[model samples]
Target: MTKILVVEDESAIRSFIAVNLRRQGYDPVEAASGEEALAVMEQQQDIAVAILDVMLPGMDGFAVCRALRERFPAMGMVMLTAKGQEQDKVQGLQLGADDYVVKPFSPKELLARIESLLRRLERPTVELGSRQEASFTSGPFIMRPDQRKFYKDSREIELTPREFAIIKLFMENPKVALSRDDVLNSVWGKNYIGDLKTVDVNIRRIRQKIEDKPEDPKYIQSIWGYGYRWLGGD
Candidate 1:
């Protein structure tokens, strides 16, 4: 059974989500606080997704998301934010969350987001039946799809699953200007119901990891009023 962690301080909301998850055949691990969520994670290493509520008793969802991203780069994360809290949504994404759900969201909507995340997490980094195509290099960066690893100048750089997918897409289509919509459809899928800002935020996060000066990125250059392009080569 697939395990999903639900961190919501409200008993009613937490129970509501857990019931829905159980109905869908997922094993829901409930945590009332961020601290408990971390404790649960320590024991439940098999947890594939974490649904974190932004308003928690202690150690807010942002902190938990950051810690989780640092400790478990591959684990999928979804933030539960109150409606109209745009900053919370952006902060969650910047902290390595794969997606966010606004308050008062239907169970179906939340489940859809979770399923989308699972699909991305389960996707093969490289196509099967092509051992020779398992790895690729662009300038100083090396990506091993089979191993799900990336390195810059021989040093491993930890990337969340979403970041890895975005970078892989960029590296594969070097020099081609890809609009935010293009990246959203390719990485997050066409069915994704989110703002285009998601693409921008992820790109910024990727730049922070891969570029020496994120403020003035050399490899991933933004095309004014359009999109972004990757300049591959040393």
Candidate 2:
């Protein structure tokens, strides 16, 4: 899945963008401040895009954007702010922001840019060498990369295309907590604006089947402030 980091201070606007993006089928991660955004990065290494609000309280968007560019120079970034200042836009672009938009911009337009950025991030698929190719497994959950099939113990698990994609990501990175944005990009395409609740809903369905007890959940664990992890047992 493609991962997105949203750095915005305003609760209303932050949620506004998040909900819309989620409904469109993209995983959306939220950071109320730049500090939190950094912490999120520490846990996840496969971020594809960042949506930054320029007038942040503590660290400001420019510093964060510049810092991110220094490390992940190829990562996509989109800056947002109430300020219409041309200098700020120029600075953000110089710092490696792919797109900059003033506040009050349409949610539709923002979603469009996000999709374009993700499209640019993807590289053509390559065939893995036979020796290096590996199947992802946890308990009865088994993923066959060659066949793209998921099995519970030896029984096949029924899944929609999206569900199959989500399972593939978790099985591939067991133990690592994946944020919602990461799930979305990995399972759904980037720029997919959809309901995030869909992730939670699907997880519930997944738990019901693989776990001995869904309420007392095992295998796929929720990481609270983070996202989900496939921890191998129930």
Query: Tens digit of lDDT per residue, candidate 1, span 1-234?
Result: 999999999999999999999999999999999999999999989999999999998799999999999889999999999999999999999999999999989999999999888987874654467543467789999988767789999999988888988988988898999999999999888988889999899989999999999998998999987889988555
lDDT of 2 by residue, 1-234 (tens): 567888999999999998888888878889998888887877875877889999999999998887776666557788895654766766665555656677678888798878765654554233676453477778777876556567887997654334555677787787888998888666555655443544666677677767888898888899887689988763
Candidate 1 overall lDDT versus native: 0.91
Pairs that collide in candidate 1 are none
Alpha carbon lDDT of residue 118, candidate 1? 90
Estimated TM-score for each candidate: 0.95, 0.52
The CA root-mean-square deviation of candidate 1, after full C-alpha superposition on the true structure, stands at 1.4
Residue 163 lDDT (model 1) = 91
Off by over 4 Å in 2: 124-234
The per-prediction tally of clashing pairs is 0, 18
